[model samples]
Target: MQQATPLQARVEGGGTPTMANWSLGSEAGVLKDVLLGPPEGFRWMGLENAAWSSLVRDTLRRGYSFDKQLAMRQHREMVSAYEDAGVTCHFLPLDEYNPYQVYARDSSFMTPYGAVICQMANPRRRGEYAACLRFYLERGIPIYDMVSSGNFEGGDFNIIGEKTALVGYTDHRSEEIAARQVAGWMKDEGWEIRFAPIDQFYVHIDLMVCMLNERCAAVCLETTEDDIVDWLKARQIEIIPASFKETMALGCNVVALGNDRVLSTAGAKDLNTKLRAAGFTVYDPDMTMFTWAGGGVHCMCQPLNREAA
Candidate 1:
């Protein structure tokens, strides 16, 4: 077995028990799978607007280096958005040399205890895990675990609450039971975890659901499983519903930036209004391309660390 990265293994001990904060570079981790072509399912996928927002295929082409620069500027703006919200956003280099932009492979999972670097099932995305794992190691972060199960992605994981997460394993990607392991591990560590199923088209649960506060969440009821919805409700988490149409546009993909605030894509007006009514400050940046890539503000960012509650 490979030795853990410096970040994966703790040093003798020190620091004020600081939590980690992480985010992905648009140029390095954006996907160009044929399956994402034309962004067919979403009528809003447009390259024109993608210019300043999404990390599109053309942005990686040597011929469109200009577009790449524009994309980077927008990416920087996105980082600034996070910083303004009291969330620290870190960026690594854009690994476009990798044909699939899979340079910094791994899921965006950071826990108070440690970070669990993922093992991507897709060969194209496999390299990224190593890159991120190495980063955490060099930076002195502890490694929680790696998804050696040969099936996992950061997209499938959601931090519903600290210590408790909902890991979704889609029938089309990984075994449904794979997530059960997460719950098991969390339980042993005084954490709680649940496995939830999301449609393959949605990619992961985060695309359709997110917690806005301790008692409120924004969900696209049309895509979330009935039971999971019920379970959430049982916890007194008010489910603020979004329309399937908006959800398909990646409107359901929102990032919480502490202080009852969230960063959203442009078209999430209806959901934004709802969140505002419920008490939240919403910010919409240049998301044309980010939205086209089938990921919105949240997918574009991997919250590496958050302050412990």
Candidate 2:
């Protein structure tokens, strides 16, 4: 596995890449550079009252307290885990206004062409992508394009392999029009897009399916459509089914660090045990506090550079 050059090192060695142009061809590629949302910005600002998902409201109603200091510590450990895997981790600038910005994966996605800025579904998250745009511009990373159709979130875009992406649509977060528009862009880029219709209970495609390695995926079969499963099978992707109980525990929301390694929460024992049995090195970090804000490991990091397998 090859470690990708850090953005700073890339700039210093190659003299600032072209503005708005970046390259990320595969999700299971050797991860070199990544963007981890800053946990320092995690704050409870009463936005839960107006949360788009009843699940989030329910979590809030349960009197779940999110500790900012603890979250920061947990994020540090996760970053350390990435470092141990030879991944270069970058972070988003803190935005006190957008507390949920810590889920960096929802703001933008990296493609072979460049970064595609997403149009957020929630009003509270509308400006988070702008911060990512700023980082790309300042660091000389190219911006491939921006989503203009209805509402789109990066969480719905799941890159499975080279030249392929699994895009999802949930009425609460991503619209079919938005998915179609993304599919069009991918088609123009000479890539295939598998449009997956998601259940309302889940937030994104990543929430139900995560690529774990070159040929394996951690999938929540209950919410995954049969056609989507067939598509994965057609591509020879091995499915590691996670039960509904494990899915609610965010077991499917794992992050692949290239090789046969995955990062997940310590609470995801069933999925972790299965992944380990499948020869994957699982790194479980305690991120229970982060989930209280309504997401898991996969939601916190965005891959900036992946060496195509």
Candidate 3:
């Protein structure tokens, strides 16, 4: 059995030591283990923070129905795709009150050192940190730190390259203060932090920008600022554009399984086709039940162990 590590692993003066067992250098590395949330208790949060998420608001406006059984089936399919890719899946303990816990990427995110717990913006979702905390502790994964400044979610913490990250905030779900707090930690560790301040309607940076591999990414030029795009280009990283319509629909949100493999949704036909043409093996699962609820596969998962890029 693995010995449990301390809840706080971050060094006060920075230069925290990296975990020997739990390693993740970049998002595009070969995914060996991933963290997921339970889908059994998932349900639509009608009128509860609906104003905070444009996708949820639009779903309510369109009078779309929520089918729990369908959601479970879709979630299983997503897991199957991950398993087929040889990625081990770890799930958080279930909490009936946190139905939105199915979107696992919001509560906390993994780093090279440990997991950084986040502060949820919505009151209804704040309890999610408990399950996240329990999971990491039980698994002996170190806890790097927690976001105490303001509201911040895991989706906004996007790692684009080695020692480089794109931290985003909307002043709504993820505030600038919290983004800086997290950025400060990364900066002190000799990382290059790029702040992307986007509109609240977009939710998180992962919604419009997700790394496809070490050298490529799927980005929504319409939603992403010019400076961010230029920065990526400056690093010789290729950009794969996703239409604004598709991006808002959560089509651009995807996961890189390394070796040119991607986990995308069936709704992302255009991007999936483009990815396939680019010699990538894509796993397109029907995730409308979750996507319509305002999160996608990327939003539903957190990488725990990724082979160094």
Candidate 4:
């Protein structure tokens, strides 16, 4: 087991509290602690600009109405499922009402040293980075650094191995410059960075590629760049290809809990079958309604501590 990195909470005056052990390395490590966003105050009824928002636009475009209550239920179920898996879970304090804040993965990126606060592309999400930074600070977690050069989000990063990371840039969300900035930081830490150029349609890299275990990955071959595939092949990582339709359904957004265990959406039947066939214990939670909001299991979670495989 890897030692926990303490999250030192800032005291009232100036000094910080005794740190709590919190550590996160790879995406598929044995998840021991996690941060989940609160789903309260997530109403769509009072929003004037809901029409242009990606969540609302995508939901309506798919011929479905946005249901805040149902989404909350689904989120609660996801948290419960994580708890059932013996993972210690933490919820982000609801300081203010942010509709899209339920997707906590976008707020910050967890590195071996500490958390890297990201600059969100969406103006509405920009505040989340600061909120997450405050959360870590108040808890005694060190802040490795902040991505100030350009817009970046945690969803664009996938830590594959102890010293390797797979990052993506969607022209609309995670800019190339910001990705390069992240690459620079990782390189400084003696890590190899694989830059994945993703299509503008996909929200983040995690939507197309998910690490199932130490040497296995679930990839959407149709959308994944050829170079990424080649890179994974060179790593000797087994690829589980998902169809285009399955990709759209967020089939590749499964979260690995280490030990060949995965948390996936019930809607992704084909992918779940494949995972089970590959000897993975697949936990299917009905996140169909929640995913309609434009993210899946992996997007909703931010791993805070995990043991290396």
In order of appearance, the predictions have TM-scores of 0.75, 0.90, 0.98, 0.89
Best by lDDT: 3
List, residue by residue over 1-309, the lDDT tens digit for candidate 2.
Answer: 744323332221223333333457777877888897777778755554335654476576788876778888888988998999999999888888888888899888777666778888888789897789778777766666678888888889998988789989886788899888878877765678888887667878888899998899999888788889989989999999998876776678998888888888887888899999999998999887777667788888889887666
Better of 1 and 2 by lDDT: 2
Model 3 worst lDDT run, 10 consecutive residues: 1-10
**Residue 115, model 3: Cα distance from true site in angstroms:** 0.1
The candidates, ranked best first by lDDT, are 3, 2, 4, 1
lDDT (CA) per prediction: 0.58, 0.80, 0.94, 0.79
Cα displacement (angstroms), candidate 4, residue 92, comes to: 0.9
Backbone-clash count (model 1): 17
lDDT computed for candidate 4: 0.79
lDDT of 1 by residue, 1-309 (tens): 765444433222322133444322111121111001111112222343243222343334323322445445555666666667655444443444222222122244655556667655545445556546555676666776665555666667677765567778775444465566555555666656677876566666777888776667889999898988998887777889989888877788777666677777668889988888888888877765445444576665555544333
Clashes of 4: 9
Can you tell me which runs of candidate 2 are displaced by over 4 Å? 1-22, 45-50
User: Which 10-residue window in model 2 sums to the lowest lDDT?
Assistant: 7-16
Report the Cα lDDT for candidate 3: 0.94
Q: Could you tally the backbone clashes for each prediction?
A: 17, 5, 0, 9
RMSD list, candidates in order: 8.8, 5.8, 1.2, 5.4
